[model samples]
Structures are given as C-alpha cells and as structure tokens.
Target: MSDSGPTIVLLGAGHAHLGVIDDWLKHGSPPVRTILVEPRDAMQYSGMVPGWMAGEYRDEETRIALAPLVREARIDWRRCRAVGLDPVSREVLLETGERIAFDVCSIAIGGAGRAENLVGRDPRLIDIRPIDGFIERWSEAEDTAPPRRIAVIGGGAGGVELAFGARNSTSQPDVLLIAGEHGLIPGHPAAARRVVERELESQKITVLTGEAQLDDDGALTVGDKAIEPFDAILAAVGSGAPSWPRESGLPVDEDGFIRVGPTQQVEGLPHILAAGDVARRTDVRVRHSGVHAVYAGPVLATNLRRLIAGRSDLATYSPFGKDFYLFNTCRGTSILSYGAFGLKARWLRRLKDWLDRRWIARFSGR
Candidate 1:
C-alpha cells in the first residue's frame, strides 16, 4: 500500500454497504480513507418494513442509523445523491455539483421503482422501493380518512406483502392486487403461490391477473376492461436499474444494471465494483432481492480490501441456488418458502420477526 492509502468510495448505504460497515466495525477500519455517499442518514430495513406498515412495529424500529455506522468506521459521509460518474476521470459528480474522486468505487444504490410507466403519469402514485418516501406517504394516507378501495400493482412477493400490509394498516376492506399473467409469485412453487392466493381470499382482497395500465384519469385498465377508480395506488412492482450506471458508460445489462463477473467487479472496469439490486452477475441469473445482496456483502468487502492492499488473491461471489424467503402477511401470520416447499403459520411469523430484528440490531448498534 502507498503512504496514503487508496481512497475507497461506497456509493450507497444499501444492504451490502451496511455489511461492509459492520465488518469494518468488527475488524477495525481498512487502511484506505473510506467515504460513504447517500442522501439519507438512515436506511430502512426492507424485511421489517411490512411489519411497520401493518402496525406491528413502530416506524423507528425499521430504520438503521447510517450516520452512527459511518462515524464509527471513520468514513467521510456525504449526504447527497450522486448524479453522474465520469469513468475517464474517475470522479463521481454529486447533485450539488461537487466532484469527488475515488481510487476504487462500489455501487450499491439499489434499483429504481419505475412508477411512471406503470401508472401512466399518474400524479398520485407511491412506490415502495424507496422505503422512506413510501413510509411518509403511507403515514399521511393513514392519518386521513381511509379510502374505499386501494390498488396494489405487481404480483411478486413485494406486491403481495404490500397488499397485506395495506389491509392491516387501513380500515378499508377493499384491497385489490393486480398481477402479471403468471399470477402471484410466479417464480415460486405452485404451493407457495396457493398460500398467498388463499390468504388474499381470506383477507377479502380481489386478485386480478393480467397486464394492467392506468388511464389518464387514474383508472386501472386490465386487458380492455376498466376497473373501478382506486382512491390510492401503491406500486410494489419490481425495480429497474437507475440511470446513472448506464450513463456512466459502464458495462450494463439491458435493463441498465451494471454487469459484473463472478468477483463482483464491473466487467471491463476492474476498479469499479457493484452488488445488491444495482448489479447483475454475468455468470448466473440472480434475483434482485435483499437476501442476495446481504449474502454478497462479505465477499464484496473482502475483494475490495484485497484490491486496495495490492493483493492479487481476491474473492469471488457464488450465489446460492436455493435461499430461504420469509413473507410477512401482516395478519398475524407469515409464510416461509424454500425451493418447492413452503410453510405458513404463526410460528413462522415469530421467526421472521426475530430474524429481522436481529439483522437490524447489528447495524443499529443496539
């Protein structure tokens, strides 16, 4: 290492970067001068966000204090969004027009919820990926009179969870879930899907399966049929890659997600690395979930440290074939799924709560 160590910049305070901060706290900081760039001082743990929405936990329970972690790790914290990156000059341009250079950079900004295309320019659309904003809107909605009907777009786990959360949080009994043609959680086993479908029925939520779009007046149109006007629209659809990566001239997938090899290093750009939803592994098809991001964190940290210290022996990320997923129904029960098998019970809900709390405790320094 040189007299002044390499400047390592962490682009986002997502799950993977949280793991990096945890590692640094435990093993002592790396030799390099580390910097963390994120607009928010705290990051909400997505796993417990449904619980918060369902009134099972307080709002503060879902947040992890990022400022404390950055302070403890001796990292320079920038409370701003990165608007652009100049790879040729190795500088990250901030929204405030400040250019910060880095010898090595890791992008973990997560994915962007493309609400514009789904809602057709609707003015009253709320997306769930950026949990902070969603939580704020949810609070405002809760404070006001409950809507007669609310529509949740997307059939994946996020959509299902949000539908249940909204049901638990509101006095309105009419919650509708609109999914794609494959139905709820199409990638999961049939049994798992059945559990969610049955719960939706039991909760009195209507399920609409097909492509859907919002009309100019904010009405949901599903395959030539226009449904009743929804008072509120919650979008839990899967996220798309942010624009910065593609505009940065980095190698990215069709969706604009940065492409990485097995080592989590951006293809054709060894100095730049990425993980979490913002990154796609070229070797294998990985789902964009918190599970994959949290698991990839340690490997990312190790590889970055090695590269900084002039070590050729770097670690590679091997994605899991089958991972355990817990879905909180927000109705006093939860569902656990692994491969083709699934289980739903109150005990599983307790387990999910414990696991989520423990994970958050790590970063919260509790």
Candidate 2:
C-alpha cells in the first residue's frame, strides 16, 4: 500500500467514532489518508435528542456540523451511504456505487427502528432512530393540524423522553406512550419509572403497557383493546444495524450486532475496527447504548494510529458496572440516577443543560 492510500475509513458518524475524528484533527493526521463515509452532513447528539423534541433545545443546538469538521480534519468526506464491506480487500462500498479503499476501516452506522415489522406501518408512522429522519418526520408531525393523537412505541429511555417531549411540544395534541413491557423505563429504578409515569399522567398523556402492535392503517392495539387512534406514530423501539454487515460475511451476533475485540477491532479481521452501537465488545455484555460509543472514540483513534505505526494494541473497552440515568425532564427538572441511586432538582437540570450546550459548542469550534 502507498503512503497516500486511505489511512482509515470511518463508516458511521456515531458518538465515539466522531470523537476519534476530532482527536485526529487536534493532534495531527496519520501517515495514511483519512476518509469518512456517512450519509448525513451533520451528526445529532443522542443525549440531547429528547431536549430537542421537547422544544427546550433547537435543532442546530444538538448537531455537530460535519462540513466544518471535515474541512478542519482535512479528511475525505464521502457524503454517501455505506452499503457493505469487503473485509478481505478492505474496501467499503456505498449505495451510490462508490467504493472507498482503506488500510483500516471502522463501522459505526448504528441501528434503525423496526418500522416495517410493526402493524399498521403507515407512511405517517415515524421511527425516531437516525437523527436526520427524526427531524424531518417531527417537522411534518408539527405541521399536521389539531387533535393530533400521537403514539410512541417502546418503553425505554428514548421512548419515554420522546413521549414527554412530544406532549410538551404541543397543547392540543394527545401524546400517548405504548410500552410493550410492563412499565415505562423498563430497566430503570422503580422511583424513576414512577416519576416519568406521573409526569406523563399529569400532562394528560396516556400510558399503556402490553403487547401493542400497529397495523397498516396507522391503528394501534394493545392486547385486543383498541386504543385511541393516532394521527402520528413515533417508534423509539430498539434497533439493529443494516443487514449489510451480516451479508458481507463479517461475524455478527444473533441480534445482527457486529462482534469486535476490546481494541475496537473487528474480530477475525485486524484491518477492520468498529465502535458505537454496531460494535459488540466481546468481553463486556453491555447494552447498545450511546455511553459505550462515547468511551470507544479515543481508544479507537489511538489504536488505529498505533496499528499504522506498527505499535501494540492497547487495553479493551469496559463499562462501569452501575446503572446511570439522567432525566432531561420536560418540566425543567433533571433527575439523575446512579445505579440504584437517584437525584432530582431544578438546578440539576440547568447543570445538565449547560454541560450539553458546552459539548455542542466544542463541536462547532467554539
């Protein structure tokens, strides 16, 4: 391979991988060329997405401008979607027929909502997964006229936050959360779930729990109980990566998650690396949350550079064994929890907002 060849090809703009790109620019470029293959011009912060939906944060406030970052990094920004990979050739093929060559490649494309599998999969139903699609769909929902009965599927953090945000965003519309499991915030503590449930109830947003399914006509039902019809449906359900990885012959888990070693390198292929939601760290069976993506960035950057320099790989990635939660409450109250521990107050919300804003500012070169 020539020195001018692509140094590392980053496949996704997920949390940690973007940080790696930032760090690479801060220090210096590696010997090889760097290329970022993503479909969007900006990456949204998943942490502040709830705030954006809630009318507390603006769209621009939550995004990192990819154009500026690409210019500053002096890396090739292929504004295209990565369809699949040839791990043997170290080539990434885009949906647009563009092929990028790389000495090292990383996959961070993340996942999408299982929209098609849901019943009543109407064109009006919105899956708030990838940030780009969410913004566009939410804009449409806002434009839709009065008496908007919106349904949010899934009971996880994203679902509850989105439910709160949607309810807070409108006055005339009815916001409903359809939790597939027993309660809102399934894995969260009892107190946290109660708080969210109480808030949704106080705001007049209906909360339903059961095996809810949507039909093709946008109707939602929970266990033979025909729920109120929804003008807009937002599915915040869990996601898996694009099927391209599994088809590409790369090793993936049963859930379609890419398996990687601790160094963020794809297992069985040293030349390939992965981070963010797509990469499943073998040692730690952590949930596919954005927190892992945040920590994987530096390690990936360092190890990628070291691999280029022929240096040894560093330690593996590990998650803190505590359950951490911070509620970006729509009521201007941020509730924070550490494992079984919990804290709630107005000042906490302000502090959390300040921190989120500061992080966004950094990405914009502030």
Candidate 3:
C-alpha cells in the first residue's frame, strides 16, 4: 500500500524464500514494498528434520524463526494461507477473504504428499511433509508408548530417512518400508540403492519392494500377501502440487506444479514467479529436492528485483551436475550419493551434520 514503490508479494516460507530473505537482509532492501505470506511464523528446515526425528537434534535446532528475519528485513509478514491467486488482477486471495495486490509475486510453497488414494483414511495415517503436523503426531505416538509396527510408504529420501528415524526413535524396531516397486530411491544409482538396502537390513527393518495397498481391514497387502498389521502408517510418497496453482488459472505441469522458465518466472506470466517444490522449471532437468530449491533462491531473488525495476537483465537458474544427497542412517553413519556413486561411512554423517548445522545457523543469525 506504499505509494512510493511497487509491491512484491512472496508466497510460502520455503528454503528458497529463506535465501531470498537472507539476500535482502545482507544487501539493502530493494526499492519495492515486500510482503511475505506464510501459514506459520516458523519453518522447519527439512534437511535437519530427519536428524530431529532420529533424536540427533532438538525441535529448536530444526526450526527457522521467520518472524525476526522478516522484521529485520522490514518486510510485511502475513501469517495466513494463500488459497487462490488472480493473475489477471495481480492479486493473491488469502484464506481470510482479503486480496493483496502485488506488482510482482513469487511462490515457494513446497509440495505435499500424495495420500488421496490410500484406503482407510484412519487417524493413524500421516504424511511426511507438512512436517510440523507429522512431528506433533509422532511426538504424541512416542509419548503414548511407541507403536508395535510402523509402516512407511514410498522409497524416496523422505521415506528412507523417516524409516531410519522411526527405527532409531522407537523402542519397537518393527519398522516396515513399503517402496512400491521403485525400491528405495530409484532415482539414485544402483550402488546407492544397495547401500540403503544393506543399511535397512542391518537395522532389521523390513522392506517390501512391490506394490502395496491398504485393505479394508486396515491391513497392508503387498502382492496378494497380507503383511503384519501396522499400528501407524506414514506416507512419504511423491510430492503433489497444491490445488491452488491450477485452480488460480496459472500454467502448470502435468503434475499440477506451477511451470516456470529458467529465470523462475511463471510460464506466460512475467509478473509472477515460482520456485522450490511448487515449481517445475521447463528449461532444465531439476529434481524436486531441497538442494535445488536452496540453489535457486538467490537467482529467484535477483530476477524478481530486476523484474520489479523494469530491467530486462534477469538471472537464470542452472542446477548442479551432480547433487550431493546425504542420508543419515541414525546409526552414527550416513550415505552420500552423487550421480551413480555413493559412499557410506561415519565421516560422511559428521560432514552432513556440520553442513546442515551451518545452513541453519546462517538463517538463525548464530
């Protein structure tokens, strides 16, 4: 509402947006009125969440205090959810029925787990994303005496990490990982998969590689075989875009993620941009990982400022050739994978812990 400058609206407090805020704080504020709309004042750094679950970190260690950061950056922080977007009118509709106009808008709202198809829909089922809720539930489960059998759906990093965390956190070691044919991080190399499999075996965690379905009796069935009954089910499957992007008339990918160019601009909409898990860049082969989101932050920030200033010179985001993905096994060890090679060792775990701590420290001003 400032007459002196155009308004820049940032949606979601994702990792990429954290970098944007850091950049704004490091340098001076841009010549634009900035507003950050997020559902929570604190964001859990996803990278440290697995460690937190594994009892290696406290809740405060994994949390990023966005309130002080926003205050320091002199940005208006709205603690609300963005239900819809109006590209034509250049406005964002909040859940409270308020529309905030922006000259430029950036979205970094991360993805959510695809859990609609699961049967039962019981209270015991949970998703790994929207991590705060999952942590709360997990804490409650821990306090009420750990479940006898815990089942984690999906084989990706989230699932594997969650499985390991659950195994380490609970007294009961009966953890089942249902990968559904992908067989634990299919995107990684064969060696990485083997390492994970070996670690799972060493941890005494049961893994079902085939397709799994929840039966009417609350039993998990894998290829016509009814495995042990699971007291708690956690879904860490593929990420799905929230319905708001498509419902708001923005161009999106087949998976419903907002489509963006190399500069992270929303397709066909120059005034709007998107990054992190909610965005799919058309110009590059970028995976929906926290690494890519962190890398894209500065680029997104620069491009947004350029667009706001009516400058044609904008930055482009190029993903790294080999992204280093480290998985903490919760046994004082970690597996580091890049492309087709992986290394599993205790030193890697220490390195990962150090890197994660450093990243969090940057945002926490510690």
Candidate 4:
C-alpha cells in the first residue's frame, strides 16, 4: 500500500475482489497502492440468502460487513458508486464526479437485472438483482404486507430456490414459479428435469412455462394471457451487465459483460481484468454463478499481484467440477446438479449449509 508505487483499482467489492483482498491479508498486499471502490457497506452472500429467506438462517448468518474487512485489510475504501469509466485513459468516474486513475484495474460489480417496466407497477413487485436492496425491501414487506401467494419469476437456480424458500415461509404461503420461455432448468438433462418436476409436484408448487412480462396494471402478462394474480412477485431472472462497461468503450459480450481470457485478463486490455458476473471467459463457455466466482477468486488475485510484481507468469482460472453445484429446496433437502446428472438429497442440505458458511467464514471476523 505504498503511496509512491503503481496503483491498482479493484472496483466493486464482489466475491472475486474479496478474494483478492484476502490474498493481501494472508500474503501481504502488493507494494502498489491498492484502492477498493464500492458503494455498498455490506455484501449479502447470495448462496445463503435462500436459506435465510426460508427461516433456516438468521440475517447476520448470511451477510458480511464490508467496512471491517476493508479496514482490516488496510484498503483505500471509497463509500461511493462508480458512475462511469474510461479504459483508454485508465480512469474510473465516481458518482461524486471524482475520477480515479489506475495502472491496473479489475471490474467485478455484480450484474444488473432488467427492471425497467416491472418495478413501479406495484409495491409488492420485487426484483432480486442489486441484492442489498432486495433484502431491505423484503424486510419492509415482511413487517408490513407479507404476501400470501408468492410468484417467483425466472426458472434459473435463483428462482427455483426462491420458490422453495417462499413455500417454507412461516405463513406457508402458496408458491408459484413462472419459469419463463425456458421451462424449469434449460441446460439440465431431461432426467434432471424430471427429478425437479417430481419435487415441484410433491411440494405443491405450481409451475408456469412462458416468458413473463409486466402489464400496465402490474399484472403478470404472458403473451396474450393474464396469469393469476399473486400477493407478491419475486423476479430472479438472470441479469445482464450494467451500462457503464459498454459506455466506457470496454469490450463486452452480447449481454454486455466484459470478455476475459483464460487467465482472467480483460480480453484486449492485459493491465485490466474482470471476474464474477461482470465478466465472461472468452476461452470457455462458463455459466455465471457464485460458485464459479468463489473458485476463480484465487486466480484473479494471482494475476493482479503478478502484474504489480513485474512477473510475466500469471495463473489461469479453471472451472471446477459439477459436484460443487448445490441448489436449496428449503424442504430440508437440496438438489445437486452438474452437466447431465442431478439428484436431490437431505444430506445435500447440510452440505450446502456447510459450504456456504465456510466461504463466508473466510472473509469474516465481525
């Protein structure tokens, strides 16, 4: 953290950036000045969120305060959002109009959900992106108008987990999952789909297959059909990249996420790198997930350190095995899936809890 050497700006206190900081804590930070800029004071680990929603864990059990971690790590933490960027000049524009320059940078801000038309339709409408807000809004909703019939949008892992969590609520509300155009899990095998379908039937969660949209009156509109109304809506559909990356002229995929190489380096910009939901690996088609980000953290950290130390050799992030994929059912059981294989088990619930807690423990003293 020298004031005179090169500067590396680690934007967004995402899972991967936290990994970089932990590396500094263990092996000592690089001599280069390190700056960590993120607006949020705490990050609610997405892995444990479903469990918390199901009343299986407390609020504190799932979140880590960023202030302490940044303070202990001695990082130059900025409590402001980044509104813009200029990769050509190596500068990050802050929401406060302050521009930060860096010799190297890594962008790990989480994805941005499509929330244009759906938000203001109703007070009960909730989109699950920008997770911190979701937690806060959920708290308000819980204390006020706790929903009796909950509709979970999206068929991905997040939506599926939300459906189960809602079902396990204290009130035991009716849960309906609108899986969008792709029914249930699209990439999973037919056998895995059957396993999930069986669970949904056993749990009494109704499943709808079609793309869902918000109508003028905040109703769930699917093409020409108006779906049955629910007391609350939770949109867990996947998110695309935020606007700043593309506005800053950085190379992005069709979805607007930065494209990185095998070594986690930004596609054309070697001095800059990205990981987690904000980046897509160019060499391999890796689905964005917290599991991948947590595993790739070490590789991202190593590369950032190497560049500062004048080392030519950098580490590559290899995707781990499918055994790590665990989806909570909130039925005292969880589903494990990788490639074409999927299964649900009660012990898998304990395994999911252990894995989630272990990851959070590494970054917690608070």
Residue 204 alpha-carbon offset, candidate 3, angstroms? 1.0
Question: Candidate 2's residue-wise lDDT over 1-366, tens digit each?
Answer: 424654688887888777787787789778678888888888888788877776787878888888888778778888889988998877788999977777878788888667656544676578877767888878766766633678888788888778877777755468888888666777667777666766677778888888777644446788877786677778877775668899999998887888898788888988788887776878776667776777778788888888777777565676766356677767788777557655677998898888778767767862
**Pairs that collide, model 2:** 7-33, 119-214, 119-215, 120-214, 120-215, 120-216
lDDT of 2: 0.77
Best candidate (score: lDDT): 3
Tens-digit lDDT string for candidate 4 (266-297): 88898889998989988888778887787778
Query: TM per model?
Result: 0.96, 0.93, 0.96, 0.94
Q: Give the clashing residue pairs of candidate 3, or none.
A: none
Worst 10 residues of 1 by lDDT: 1-10
lDDT of 3 by residue, 21-60 (tens): 9899899779789999998968888887777877889999
How many steric clashes does model 1 contain? Answer: 0
Q: How many clashes does each candidate structure show, in the order listed? A: 0, 6, 0, 1
Residues 1-366 of candidate 1: C-alpha lDDT, one tens digit per residue: 213557888999999989888888888888889988899978988888778877899988888988778888899999999988877778899999998888888999999978776667675578986778888887887788666688888899899998888888757547889987878987887778888888889989999998778876667788889987777888988888899888879899898999998889999888889999899999988888898899888888898898788787889877766467888999888987788877789999999989898998888753
The CA-based lDDT of model 3 is what? 0.86
Evaluated against the true structure, the overall lDDT of model 1 is: 0.85
